[model samples]
Target: MEGTEKPVSALGIEKDLNDWLSVTKSRNGTWWHSAFHNVSAMVGAGILGLPYALSELGWGPGVTLMVLSWVVTLYTMWQMIEMHEMVPGKRLDRYHELGQAAFGEKLGLWIVVPLQMMVQAATDIAFMITGGKCLKKFHDTVCPNCKDIKTTYFIMVYASVQFVLSHLPSFNSIIAVSIAASVMSLSYSAIAWMTCIHKGVIPDVDYSPRSTTTAGMVFSFFSAVGDVSFAFAGHNVILEIQASIPSTPGKPSKKPMWKGAFFSYIVVFLCYFPVAIFGYWAFGNKVEDNVLLSLEKPRWLVAAANMFVVIHVVGSYQVFAIPFFDMVESFLVKKIHFRPTKSLRFITRNLYVAFTMFIGMTFPFFGAIIGFFGGFFFAPTSFFLPCIIWLVVYKPRRFSLSWFTNWFCIIFGVILMTLGPVGGLRQIIVQAKQYKFYS
Candidate 1:
């Protein structure tokens, strides 16, 4: 392939390849980079659906579950960061590396890589649809008289940006985009809740669950759990973000990474809570899946909020897409023995973006897809997989507080993983029955 570089020896070949790849070559990131990257990765289109999730769960269980998810995911995220440099002189830079350290090499790769990739891919597809829907929303809000454009075209427009941003090469390279995404996430989230409050509760608004049948309500509740689980899904990429930070014996990466993550969590709290609570409070049980869609009165403000969403997801698509790029590139160079070159990277990245864009256009059921992906993949990776790995690697005393805590998380996470997909799948089927293809 063009621009391929050959190394002098076998050892040189491995090192040379790592250097050529985008992620491994970067080690200049700071704590603030971690702050915004975490914010960008963690706060995404998922937050927009939270009010709808709340509508399914109702006030008490809804609020309680959201708070618990915040606490548990925060604790688990801290564990992932700490484990990043747990091997003293060596850094477990990627999630799979940490998994290999805990489980045997093959088992670790089998367990972690599939789950992580699914989460990343699912998130990217969800963000694609989200970005497209928001673009259409923005257009409709601002120029209602214009001829209606097909959503598939709008999704293609969103993916066009990703086609460019995907080639940025490294996590560090996208720092500026991540920072802007973080700001936009906070801004649009505030706009979502504030507008809801401004509108006040809908006249004679009903707080009742949407489903009338008992089975339907149960499934709706389970699907909502999936949605909430999906909202905290930045765990899959935390180690990757830490991988970009420079680490040494005297100054480990964990300290700065955790500091940055703590601030990001505060941003997560700010962006998630009021939006979930007040959005539901104002709209009651009738809020749209993306809360911005529910408020259309202040045409200019709603349009601006939708534009913020379009920009925010533009950054978010790249944040989630980086790992997918790394994994595929690594596989091509190592397992398949393809030369590391610009041509290979260009082909791999463009194809991946196209795949996600196609999926989003075909089945852009945002709420249902979030619920399904959240429960099926995210619940395991974000909710409890870290605790399981910690127990295997560290073996904290059987009945100690740490062990009990991990056990609790594992049990809770397993419940979510099992039930969330059932509800989400059912909803997808229902939506699909009435939908036209790529309309």
Candidate 2:
């Protein structure tokens, strides 16, 4: 396949591929910038969705899960730093290329293609669903005929908004939006915490005396790890940022990007840990999909939190959409030789938005979507991908030991991924059996 291509069209494809490939070789970004970009990417839907995950494991297991996730994320970040240093100019697209270089094309594609699609699809669903929920909240609060507004409507509207927002002309504008959304989310979360803490409405689930079986312990560990994986799954984004960094005209300093990643992990863990712990402590077993629900806040505060969550979810969708859209664009241009004209870019962007919104509208249950994606698709993408990439790229001296760790991480990721989906599926199926439709 590599040696026998003679078609002129194939030459065009190769040229396009080479053009995209050039981005990987331009090493010009800083660690702090990479960290901020990554944080913006990962901190969205995960923060809103993690509390419910914690509820499943109870307090001790939950706290353990948070810490374990942080540790695993830190380790993964270190590995990512190593990969960046080893292959200084490669992006996620280049990871598969690296895999091909290290192993073979078939093996590389087998791993990268499916994992990439799964992660993006699941993330898109999460963004759409959460966005719909936020819009619903707004609708219920502001509209007189709020009950008439269907979940599908909100999903469609939000999806359209995402498509438009993401397709804006400038990168600076998008960054500005991300910054604004982050600020709003942080402010609202602070207010929600204050409201909840002041009212003393946080629930207390006593899991101190519960028997911790071996299997239970394992589940807790993976679940926590899974949470961390979700929280820190922006290594791809980091690489993208790294690739965007401008190299010196004549010479660039060889600063380790992992130093930035290490500190970024610390900053993320510090931000997430307190929120997860306190949010869980406040709500206990009764924590709802949005942890803010547990807080007995003023109407205005609740409204503010809902708006913040909506903005956060929307911002996340935009961030996720960029890569997904980029991949789509790359495939079309490189594989199909389709030029990315302004009109073509607009159409493609809108198409993704419409498709994602349609899915969200069809499946209005945010919790179910989060559970399914987090457990099934996200688990492997988060935990297994890095390990597999390490094993394949590095081959690590001891093939057997590396293989064992690779499989171990994969198995652990798979289990964590399954629990949420299986449990969520059970709940959905049972509910369907009992009732004709979603209430």
Candidate 3:
């Protein structure tokens, strides 16, 4: 027992370790591009819901939750990186890999797998809902004289486009797409903020007093928390995006990740704030679920903004779906005994895409879907699992600051999980009754 441990050299050099962990497998881009990619993942079409979130909680609670979400996500990045850096022998480069490494294979397989799949899939569906609605609106605006088109048809078309594009084999392939999506996301965000800022700055029209006692403030407060939580989510894809940063001297450079994390948050706040604050200021409780819908005539700009939404969400959906595809492909390979052949990859991935799209078609109520996924999936993916995993993997001193932070996150997530979905389901049911399938 005295001489059993291996030497440092025997542990393999940093290069060998990086290769084993697959962290450097596709280090195809610089950190800035990687930053944009991850930033894209975080600031999804869910940003559209911020106005509504603000409308529900009023100024103080709404802004507080949003800042809290940002802080939670930043903390998540710190702990997750600490776990990745702390582990010995090999590193955890993927979400499930981290789960299995920290917990056990069964927990990773049963828990992380399904949770990641649900969050990503539900997020993808959200993109479809938003994308379809945007495309239909754009169509209606541009071709008002033309015959009406069903939103479902636009959703199907959007799905088909994604089906073709999602077949690219690796994250490296989508770097350009992610970059483009990130840019468009920023573009539309700017346009949205400018539109709102202009309205709010105007002397005549103002939309203060967005929230009141219509519903219980407590319930509305948590509901907005869920929405912002969803808006800030990136935990599932964080590792994958982090892994894409170019490794220098054959070790994945944490410097780039650290820098990117800081920059990415800046980008998040820049995009999220004006839209939330100004949009609420401009339209108050009269705001639409999608802030864009609240914008007045200037048919061209509304259509322009939504056109970007269509493009951004199309790319964003594919980005999120990659993780889901990995989960499904792994299950098919190990659980179902499917060989990793080109044909099987084609069949499984496309079929999964079709299945998610079908779900999107069935429920076109964007807010309800976002709420449910945010509460059910985002809360855990962003907070609960990371906290639990950190405590298990790092073995932080019990009852200390580390312990308290992790437990706090877990409890926050638990509360959110419990209340977020109940509020969300009520919204979903209301929408379902209001839903007309193809309209």
RMSD of each: 3.8, 4.9, 4.3
lDDT (Cα atoms) of all candidates against the true structure: 0.90, 0.60, 0.75
- Compose the digit string of candidate 1's lDDT tens values, residues 79-163: 9998987776677777888889999889999999999999999899999999999999999888999999988899999999999
lDDT of 1: 0.90
Q: In candidate 2, where is summed lDDT lowest over 10 consecutive residues?
A: 247-256
- Identify the candidate with maximal TM-score: 1
> In candidate 2, which residue ranges exceed 4 Å CA deviation?
1-29, 85-95, 139-148, 169-173, 201-232, 247-260, 397-411, 418-420, 433-439
Clashes per candidate (backbone, < 3 Å): 0, 8, 0
Tens-digit per-residue lDDT, 62-144, candidate 3: 78777767777789876776565455555566788788887787778677778887788778888888888889888888777
Clashing pairs in 3: none
| Candidates arranged by lDDT, highest first | 1, 3, 2
Candidate 3 global lDDT = 0.75
Off by over 4 Å in 3: 1-25, 201-218, 246-250
lDDT by residue (1-439, candidate 2, tens digit) is 7877578987775555544432332344465545555556667667765665666666676777667556655565565545654555433334445455455779876766566666766677777877777777766655535457666767776776786696664222365566666565566656655664676533455433222566544444334334445655664444444554544424332243565556556656655765676666666656665776565346666766777777777766665666666667777876797876767678888888877776666666645445545665666655666777787677767758757766667676666676656554554554554432222
- Candidate 1: pairs in clash: none
Compute the lDDT for candidate 2. Answer: 0.60
Better of 1 and 2 by TM-score: 1
Worst 10 residues of 1 by lDDT: 2-11
